[model samples]
Target: MAKYTEEEIRNFKKITCKIAGDYLGVSSMAVSIGMRNDLLPIGFAIKKDDDRYSESWSYHIVDERLIAYKHGKINELQIQNIEKNLNTIIEQFEEMKKDLLFILSEDVD
Candidate 1:
C-alpha cells in the first residue's frame, strides 16, 4: 500500500472493509475477522445481532489510523490506548443493551 497523505486520508468519511482489504492485499472477510478479534488497529468491528441465532459485523475505519497502521507508525502505546478505548466502548454498549431491554420490558398504557 502506498503512503497516503493527510489530505487524502481526511477525504474519507469511513473506509469500507473491501477498500481496506484491497489496500492490505487481503480478503474482506480477513479484514473483518482481524478487526473483530482486535488484531487490526485501524478501526472497529462491531458485531450486530440480527436475530436469535444470526449476527453481522459493522466496520468503522478511521482513515488516519489506517494510514498510520499501513505505514507502521502506530506504536505500542497507541495500540494499548486503542485496546483500552475499545474495552470502554464494549462496556458502554453492554450497558446500553441492558437499558434497551429494560425499556422494552416496561409496561405502557
Candidate 2:
C-alpha cells in the first residue's frame, strides 16, 4: 500500500549513485543518469527448471522519471521481505515442478 514520491526516489537514486561511484570507482553521474534515464536493471526474479533453479533478481523499479514504490521499497526490512518472498516463490516452483513431466522437458532415465 505504501508508495514512493518522485522526489524521494530521485533522492535515493542520487544516494545510490554516490555510493556506487565511491566503491566501484565509476562516475556518480553514470549511476545518477542511469536512474534518471530508466537505464537501470532493477527487476528481480527467480527462474526454475527441472535440473536446477535459477535466480534472477531485480528491484521493483519505477520509471526513472515517474518513480514508484510498493510495500518493499521503503526500508531495509521491507526489502529483505520482498527478496524472501521472491525466493520463496522460486522454492515453491521447484517443489511443484519436481515430479511434473513437463518440468523435466526430457527424461534422463
Candidate 3:
C-alpha cells in the first residue's frame, strides 16, 4: 500500500476500476478482477450499502494498486480473469464507470 496524507486520500473523490484503468492504461476489467481476487487493494472508498447492484458506493485508489498492476504484480489467475473480449470488456467497463459515478453523486445535492 502507498502512504497517503489525509487530504490526499480525500482528494481522490472519484477513483474506480475504470479510472484506475485509465491511470494505468489498462482495461477496467483488469482492475475489477484484481480487486475481486484480492490481488490488489480494494481502494479507499467503499460502498455504504450492501447492494452492489445499486448505485451506492465510493472509491479512491490511494495505494500502489494501479502501479502494481502496470508493473506486472498480478498473477496468472488475475491475468486470465481480465482477458475478456475487448469489445465486451470496454462496453461493460463504461457502464460500470457510469454507475459508479452515479453512486458517488447520489448524496450530493
**How many residue pairs clash in all the candidates, one count each?**
0, 7, 0
Candidate 2 lDDT trough over 10 residues, lowest sum: 64-73
Q: Write the per-residue lDDT of candidate 2 for residues 1-109, one digit (tens) a residue.
A: 2343545555664334444444334565655555444454333222334445654322233344223222223544554677799999999998887868665766655
- Model 3 local distance difference test score: 0.60
TM-score of each: 0.62, 0.34, 0.36
Tell me which of candidates 1 and 3 scores higher on lDDT.
1
Off by over 4 Å in 1: 1-9, 75-77, 82-109
Task: State each model's CA lDDT, in order.
Answer: 0.80, 0.47, 0.60
lDDT of 2: 0.47
Candidate 3, poorest ten consecutive residues by summed lDDT: 1-10
Tens-digit per-residue lDDT, 75-109, candidate 3: 54654555446667899999999999999899685
Local error of candidate 2 at 102, Å? 8.8
Best by lDDT: 1
Candidate 2 shows a clash count of 7
Where is model 2 more than 4 Å wrong at Cα?
Answer: 1-73, 102-109
Better of 1 and 2 by lDDT: 1
Better TM-score candidate (1, 3) = 1
CA displacement after TM-score superposition, residue 5 of candidate 1 (Å): 7.4
lDDT of 1 by residue, 1-109 (tens): 4444566666867778777776667887888898898888888888887767878789998887777877799854797987799999999999999998888889552
**Model 3: clashing residue pairs?**
none
